[model samples]
Structures are given as structure tokens and as C-alpha cells.
Target: MSLDNLPDGLLLEILLHLPLQSVFQCKCLSNRWCSLISTPYFTHRYVSHLHTNLQPFTLLFECKDDQSITRVLATNSDEPELKSLAAYVHRQSEHLWLEASCNDLLLWRSKDDGESSPMSVYYVINPITRQCMALPPITLPYHRSWIQAGQFRVYIVSSNTREWSESKVLCQEGFELTHFALCAVPYKSLLFWCSNSGRLLGIDPYNTRCCRSFEQPIGWELDKETDCFGVCRGYLRICQISMFYTRFSSILRIWELKDYDNEGGGKWYLEHEVSVNQLVSKKSPWLNEHVQQKYPLPLVLAFHPNDGDILYLAIELKVLLCNLRSKTVEVFCDIPHDPDTWNDKCNIINFVLPSWPTPIPFAPLQNGA
Candidate 1:
């Protein structure tokens, strides 16, 4: 095609359909296409244009290269330059990598070459803008040794400066129960889970008050000791059993959480709960389309970023967009699989779009990260 033949706007539209890397490649096609793609007008269109306004979704997987794995971002579109963002916080778990992305800011941690230990670092980077803010050193008040089998998680809340509180989840099998507290928040609301005693506690961070707690009904008795439940939902979720036990005849529930005295207390009213059979049947057609593969775990669910009345879920083969307004669920296909679809090898992780963007707190990348 003759580059000069097309109107500038038409050329811009064509470039918008391609990923940034491919646009870079087109630079070799001709000086005109190259110069036009570099213009602010074309760059803006290329950044914002997406087939679905649906927040972009990407998959996270670790590649083992000589006992060291490099993590990178690969969208459903499979842009070839997805590896350009490689060299992020190098030593991290799948969960940590999945947690890095928020609205537009990506947070990650890496090792400090000079220090004996990996760098206890945090940075906010925006791939689109390619800006990063590396935060000053932050240390948890408690001794690391005190925390048993501990792991750290960072929660980024939206603010002018992008609020982030680095915290760790601590547990001790030797103690009466496993302890979890929010170290980054005002005061510390520590939660205690006793798989042996079937007890759950919520402690006021400021006064260490035994705020309020509910015991799962006796029917969840085994949960008191041998079994364990973790909150997959965010801050509002508490998985302690009902204080009273009834016949156990239902599936896992998504009970609506209620707040009391500025703390989560009182009975949990279910927002919605689907039985095992119905939930299975609903996903069956989609699974059969895959020619029979075990479905991914506790199907990921989250509030749609743009719509309050809807929620979104991800299965192996497709994304399920549920309309809360109409109380109907619609299945959409966006996942990419080749003719070699019998996929295995890596575990799948699900995450929502980041809601906050932090300043790029990172040191200047070598020629820019």
C-alpha cells in the first residue's frame, strides 16, 4: 500500500489496531509511516483504542532459565515486544507478580545487589507512560523472625500520591492459631485463625480490643480444628463459621458482609450463593467447548471496574461478564489457545485491574525500564 495515498486520520486508525511494538516495526516500512506513527496524535490513538472497553487482561507465568525465572507481561493479543517490560522486580512469586498491576501503576520488589538480602524495595511503574517511582526503604515494625512462614503483600489505594502500605501475613503453627494483621494501616487490626479450636478473632489495632467475633455453627465443627478457610474476597470477607451450626447441605457461599461499630461484625447475609450442581452446569457448556479439561479453581470473581451492577469472572477458555442489573451472566471468549490446546505446565492466576496509580518510584532504568 502507498503510505501517502491514505489520509493521516485513516493511517492513524490502522496503526491503532496494532500493538506499540508492531507500530515500531512498521517504522521500517517507510519514512512516512514511521514519522506518522511517532506523532502525538497517532500515539494517543494507539494507546486508547481497544476492541472492548473491558479493562485489558493479561496472563502471568514464570519462565525458568537456568534456576532463575524472568517474569514479563503478555496480553491476550500476544504482542511480540511483551518482553520489553521484563527485568521487573526479579525475585517474586506468581502471587507477588499478579499483585503488581493496579489501575495503571505496576508495583514490584527486587534485590539490592550490594545488600546481603534481596532489596526490600517498592516501585510504581506505568508501562504506557514508562514512568516509575521507587519508594524509600520501608521496614515492618515487627521482627521478621517473629513472623512464621511469613509473606509480604502491598495494597495500593488511590490518592494524589498513590497510597501504599507494605504489610506481611504472619502465621505460627506452634501458637494457638494463625495470626494475620494489617501492619500498614492505622493501629493494627490483627486477625487470628485457629484451625484446631475453630475460633476466629478480630482485634482492634489501636487498643487490641476483642472487637467482635462469630463462631462458625457447630456443623462447621471440623473447621474448628482440622480444616481451614481463607478469605479470597478482599478486606470485607471473614470466613469464620456461623456461630450456630445447621445441617450442612449447601455449597460454599458468597455472603454479603455487614459492618458494625466501624468494624466488620454481625451476621453475614448472602449476596448470592449457587449450589455445586448449578454452578457446575452453568460452566459445563463453556468447558465442553474446550473438549474436557478440569476447570480452574474457585472461579475468580470481582466487581466490574466500570459497572457497579456487574461482576466479572475468568475460566480457562473465556471471560464471564455478569450483568447485575439484569441478573444474567454472559460468556465472552478472549483467551488465546493454539491447535496445541492441551495446555499444561504453568499454574493460572487471576487478578483485577489496578485501581491506583503511584508515582514511578524506580531508579532510572538502564536506558529506561
Candidate 2:
């Protein structure tokens, strides 16, 4: 590896654990690891270390601000007049900013992401200790004759609370099984795991204690689609849906919520069923050793909003760069097509998806109906 004693940030920290088209073909391998892997903190430290359930520096919102006001962005890449770091603001939400982000937290939701009404998340705020809280929106409580709190969703198994009323949990509403999510539990801690909502809980983040409830494992299916997005694939929290189901071809379906507790209702189960075409054939030759990648698995991961245990999956259709530490699977359908077409059809439409969470304007998801 001698180009004159290579160390460009340790070969961009091993090309930030290589895989985002091999960090852009190692930037033609030579302009100094292509400006040290095209700095954005080298894909934010290759996605915040590729895992450990992540958290490194995220918050890329801009629902309006460009001058219209309503911010909370971040990228103060050491600021120089806000390379991007706006911070926070929500007096009218302006037009909605965050939809999901973790590891320095930010998931902001006012009433969008399919908008059925009653949806909330804005906890985990430390805009440098300004302190914030206003969660409990994604509604749905349960049993008043089978669900109705506008239909359900408040899935915040945990939000790294800084003040959450003194740490959460109440269950109240109508409780029989309400439906919940927003999770993290690989090395343990950070949760809100429920489905069809039974009795398995673990609260704190100021919803205030029940601490741990149990019993769950009947049919199991708590994915009240907020476009169903989750990440944490080795201790499972997998949930991702690009909409498919030749009757559940199962492009991913995991649910392993344990800490033990069963009161005839929940302990939850079904810990397996992910086959995005066998993770696109085990990520085709390890994503052809990086450049144009590939993927297919029941894939969908998040937490690369700008690195911190860098886990970003949602392959061949956006949110690229899979695998960093624990759950790193890669296969962009042999992404190479300068003309091979990465195997044509616009590589099934422009190498799937590797851009757009913001820059605003988004659409596409209707194919096949």
C-alpha cells in the first residue's frame, strides 16, 4: 500500500470501512485518497463507525429555511458561516423538517409521513443543552373494541431523553395491545418495542415506569407504517418496507424483543424472515468489492444521517452503504454499469437509491400498485 507511506486518515479509516461505491472509486485512487475520501467527515466517519447502534452527529433538516425560517440542521463542519449547522426551531414547524435520525437524535414529526393524524417525536434534544420535549404523538392506544386513537402510533420505545418528565411509561389509554416501535437493543438499552400492543414494555425517557412488562407471541405485527423504517440488524429491529408481499415474500421481518416478561400477552417473537433475494445473493461478491454496489434483502436501515456507528441501508432504491460493523450486508446488483447498465433498466432506476432524505422533493413508490 505504498503511494508514499499511505495514511490519509488511515486510508480514510479503511475507506470508511469501504462500500459506497468504494468511497467513489477511491476517488480515482490518487488525489490523496481523493481528498481523503471526499470529506463530509469521510462519510461522517464512515457512518458513525458502522454500528454499535450508532449516534455520532446527525440533524439534516430544512423543511423551509433558506431564508424562510424554521431550522434545525447540522454540519457545522467547524462552521465557516454555517456550512449547514442551523440547529433547532419549531414554532410552526414551518413545514416539517425531520422524519427520522438517530445518534445525536432528531426524528421530528408533527403530522406527516403518510399523515393519518396524531404523530409526535422531538425528544432527545440537547441543542447544546437548550433542553426539549414534546413526544407522544404517533397515536393509537387500544381495546375500546379493537383500536382507535385515530388509528395508532407513538412508537418511541425510547428517545435518549434528557428530561422526559422524569423518564417514561404509562400504558393508560385503552391498553390491550396498541402498537409501537422506535427501538435499539443490541448491546441493550434504548427501546419501545410493542406490536398489536400487548404487555411487553420498558419505559424511561419520562413516560415514567412500568419498567418491563411481559408476554407476547401470538401472530405479532406492530409495523404501523411510518413508511416502516428501522435499523439495528444483529439484535434485530429490522423493519423496512418498499412495499412487497407476494403474500409476505418477506423482504425483512424481525422482532426479537426480550428482557423477559409474559403476562399472557407479550414476550414477542418471530425473530427471522429476511430475504431481499437472499440479501441480493449475499450482496453479490461483497458488492463487487466496492464501486457500484448492490442489494435486495428485506433491507431498510437508518442512522447515517451523518455518521455515528454508521448504519444506512435501504438498498437499490436509496440510503446506500451497507455494513460497517455488526450488520453490514452489501449487493447493489453488481453496481458497475457505466454501460453494463449495472444490468440495465436504469439499474432498475438509477442504482436504486443513494440520495434524497432532503434536498426536499421526493416521490416514487407506486410501481405494481
Candidate 3:
């Protein structure tokens, strides 16, 4: 009748249904459980099961100045929880930069004293396990004599080998990139990053040099301020808002990259388009004028994993779930902020982990399950 007395197969079945965090905690209960759970066969099965169920997505907001991370469940209305990531860094570490996230694995850069060090300080974390590991540093190539050298690298831990690997990317030829728009979700064994020049670079975690490159969606200028990229149902999604200099109106378009792995360059297919005027008129009529001048259009957060018609967006300090099917908008939750105290020095940025049915443990697969 006791859990320890249960058959091994039944125990694993029960563990597979448990949340990923709980499963990780269960590993510490006993050596038998740990060995069984850590087995390659069990790990892959658990991951495969979770992927089929479609886990709910979570949002991680970074307070730039304080270097603190806040986690909120995007599926429902909930208060944000400040996650303590201090155990991973030195006590003196003040700032942790969120470079990117894929399959619930977060990539962070450590800023020590703001002075450029030849060694890169990067960390990879699995929020569920509360585990963090630092990566070996690589010196970046100098750009121009005056400008400091900055390189973008993605550190991905192999599920099979349990080893960390990184991919190095360069600025596009004939074009100078200031920053890159990190993709919301990684797709098909590739992590996609969009440069300021509207170029898409795909990083192959297995091989750094075999990386792939593609042009951005036609006619889309992915300025860091106005446009962003996300993944919905394993498709590359880009939402862009453009404003006219002469007129006060703005246009918003959402497109998906289809057959992105095509032999020829893949084509972008328009998924949905809406006008800022219509959204303002229906959602916030009072702020019609402020939208074009004072406020930027809502940034696309994440698309619903099961429901293709639903997507999340951030406007002002609120996260809204916009449904294309009903043409309705509802507030999912509010971004954490202090109204009593106003400080212009604080850094705040919002991000959503778009990978649905988040990837499971890294244990290699055995024979067929």
C-alpha cells in the first residue's frame, strides 16, 4: 500500500503525470526513485508525455536596474512572484542580463562593474529545477577601434550528452546591427534571432559553424523599438506596427514563416492584420491620440498553444489576451509595479516563454518506449 512498495512501472506512470518541478523534487526522496527517474527511458517518456499534454506558458519579467526576475503564470490571473536567482551568482553580482530563453531554459549574461572583460560571463538556468550553471567564457572579436566588441552567443545543454554548447553569430555583411530581437520560441532544433538589419539567423546547437541564415519577412523592418518575433504552434511569427510620418494612423500586421526549412528561401504568409485605430476605438477609445504619440502599440507576447486564434500582448502595464476568433480582448493580468513610489532609474522589461508543453529532462533515450 506504500509508495515504495508500488511496482516500478506504476511509480513511473504516476511520476510522469506530476508537474516537472514535483518530478525533480521526487528524485531526492530515495536512491531507487532517483535511479529510475534519471534513467534515459523514463526521462524521454516523461518529456514526450508532457509535450503531448501542452503545458501552460509562464512569463518572466526582468527588473533591469535591480537585476531581479519576476515570474507570472500566463494562463490565468495571478500575482507575480519574485524569483531568487542569487544562489547561482556570486554574492557581489549586481546585474543579470536575460539574453534569451528556449524550452524553459534561460540564458543570462552577468554584468560585473560595467567594464568590458575579455571573458564572457554567461549562465544557463532551468527555472523549474532552480539549477544554474556558468558557461566557459569566449572572447569577442573587436568591431571597430572605437566601438566595443559585443557578440551574441546561445548556450544550449545537450539532452543526450548533458554537456553545454554555444553558437557564435556575426553581423550581417554590408549592414551594421545594433541589437537583435530574440525569438519567442525555438523551433525544429534551431534558435532564430532577428538582427536590426531584418536578417534572420538560425543557430544549430549541435554545430556552431553549420548555422543557417535567411532574410527577414519581405517589407518588414524589424526595428528593436517597434517590431518583435514569436513562435506559435511551431511556426515563426512576427508582429510589426508601423506609423506614417504625415498621418497619425498606424498599421499592424502579423505574419508567419511557412516551410522555413525550404531549400529555397522560405516565404512569409500573412496570418492576420489589424489597424491601430480599430483596436484603440474598441479597446481604449479614450487613448486614441495617445497611442500614436505617447504610447507604442501593444507588443506581441505569446500565442496560445492549443488555440491558434488566441495570442497574448502587452499594453502599458497590462498583459491582454486577444482572440481573433471573437475579436475580443481581455486582461490576463497586470505587470508588477509600484505606484506609491515612482523612480525613473528602474529597468523593466516583459517576456513570455512561448514554448508549449515545455521540454522535459535531458536524459538520452534508450530503446523504443
Candidate 4:
């Protein structure tokens, strides 16, 4: 019997073993295959299979310049599909800005011109499915500016609705919500923003009223530049570097949020602590050259999604992978620009591509009526 004559159950089983890109190509063979691959059941099963087999995910570094050109670097440059996805997004629009990235969805913003304005359009895209949904335009209040006082508005788009909604978050009386909007971190069902004062603001997109602020982790200093926050191994984690002013020694501490909804706001447990100088000297001496300088401290770019002990660090223009357990460091890749240039215009995003395409939740009436 031919492959086309195979039963649906058997065909699905075979397709699940193929690579993600191959499965995408299989969809174009016929409408029947496309429908089968697009079903929720197929996606669920395929994702489970990928997890069981330990499919590796890629990391993307995005740098934006003055001309609105975004430069993306992927850890796994050998993968054609990953490179194509990055190229596709840039090709779509030169002025496109990547706002935030969740599990399988990427939130993008496009301005009407080269300058900032209130009339900005947002889009939610799934690279795997090659689908895009453009949200309704947003108009801010005329009186208040983007960072006026201690108030900021968050625009939210839900899978159930075709239109976008807004939520206002009030900060502490004296604190200003500066730079936090550009570095919003999406984890689980809530979005988290860390202020320069080391305070954390979390909000649930589904319910705008459920917003809360948590104190900074113990030992973290306010207005310090040696800290970074990210999610690792299914937990929210933060990495902080403390230096000894007298000596050239610095200690790196990793903290994990054990409980966030407790009465004390949240509880953080010290996960890992290691000496930066010793770790670098033992394995990679090149990185230790810059450790003595107090001005340019090593920056933590991201943590390994599957392994909590592995970390990605930027020492200057080069990115290195350090394993805490083995006390070893290796250069992962070198970036063309300075890593310290990451600011409002430049960003480093950690993207993990899901095995199966997530269905775009566009409302039925969005296409018409």
C-alpha cells in the first residue's frame, strides 16, 4: 500500500517522528495532510514527543540600531529553519520591534514612522505556524506621557479576543516605571517587569485587576547594573553579581523564587553561588582579563532552559557558556557589537522554539464583520 493510503492514526505516528521543518513541508502535500497536522490533537501529541526525545531549542540575540534595523544571532546557526525564521521577521518590516516572547508566540510592535508615536500597531506571530495576527491600534491618554508620574499602561491581547485591551499599573509613590516596559519578561501566565530600584511588578494578562509588586531579593542593591532576571528549569530565577571594592574578587549568586503568592509577597531561595574570578581562571583565562576591571563586569545573558546549572554570560563582545557544577567555561559565540550596548534600542532575547506550531487564536469575525 502507498503512503497516501495509510490510516490517519498511523500517518500521525509517522509524522510525529519527523523534524519540525519536515512536518511543515508535509502539510503542503495535500489539504487532508494540512488539516491533520493543524489539529490540536496532533500538535499536543507532537509536542509531547519532542519533549520525550529531548529536542534542543535555539537562543536568539537581537540588536537594534538607529536605522530600525535588527541584527539577530542564533546559537544554533546550523539550523536552516531557525535562520529562515529570523530572516523572515526582519524582511517583513524594517521598523518592526520585538517586544516580548513567550513559549511559542512573539509579540511585535510596528510604528507608523521612524519616530515614536501613540498610534503603534502590535502583532502576535507564531513562526512555526507561519501565522500573524495584527492587533488594534492603541491611543494613549493625551494629558499623561508614557512615563508620567508613577503610572504606566500595559496593552494586552488575549487569544479569545481579536481586539487588544489595556491595563494601568500604579507604582509606589516615589518610584518611576522607567526602562521596565522595554524589558518585560513573560513567564507562565504572568508578565514580570523589574525596575531599576530592584522592585518586581507582575501582572496577569487574563485579569488586569490581579497586579502586584514584590520586594527585591535579599542582598540585591538598588540601581545596580550587575544583575539579570530570567526563567530557568520551570522557575523564575535571577542572577546577581557582587564585587569587593577593595579586591578584584566578585561573587555571583543565583536565586530562585520558591513562592510568589505568599503573604510576605514572595520567597527567594539561594540556588547557586560561585566566584567569578576563580571560575574564569580555572577554565577560560581570556574572560578573567576583564574581571579585574570594576567598570565592565560580566553580564548574565540567559540561563539554560533545561539545565539550571548552565549559564550564558557576556564578558565583552564574546558570549560564553559556564557550567557551575563542572567549574568550566567555554566561548559559545562572539558578537560584533559590545554586549554592554544592550539598552532601549538594543536587546538580547532568549527564544525557545516549540516543536509544534501553536494555533493562532484569531476571532472568527476578525476576517470579516
Please provide, for model 3 over 1-369, each residue's C-alpha lDDT reduced to its tens digit, 9 standing for 90 to 100. 999999999999999887555676788999999999878898788867756544455555444345554433334623121122222222223455566666556677665443466455676665545555666565544321222224555655665665556565554563333223433346677766655545666766666665666666666755533355667777876666776556565666777888765454577787777655554435555445544455545666656655667767666666667776565566667776531232322222333332222344433222210
CA RMSD of all predictions:
10.4, 21.9, 7.1, 4.2
Output the lDDT of residue 51, model 2: 45
How high is each candidate's TM-score?
A: 0.43, 0.24, 0.69, 0.84
lDDT at position 352, candidate 2: 11
Show where candidate 3 strays beyond 4 Å: 48-52, 66-95, 114-119, 138-186, 203-211, 218-226, 244-248, 280-296, 301-307, 336-369
State which candidate, 2 or 4, has the greater lDDT. Answer: 4
Q: Distance from true position, residue 109, model 2, in Å?
A: 8.9
Residue range with the least summed lDDT across 10 consecutive positions in model 1:
179-188
Instruction: Name the lDDT value of residue 161 in candidate 4.
Output: 64
How do all the candidates rank in terms of TM-score, highest first?
Answer: 4, 3, 1, 2
Candidates, ranked, lDDT: 4, 3, 1, 2
lDDT values, one for every candidate: 0.42, 0.38, 0.57, 0.70
What TM-score would candidate 2 get against the native?
Answer: 0.24
RMSD from true fold, candidate 4: 4.2
Error of 2 at 228 (Å): 22
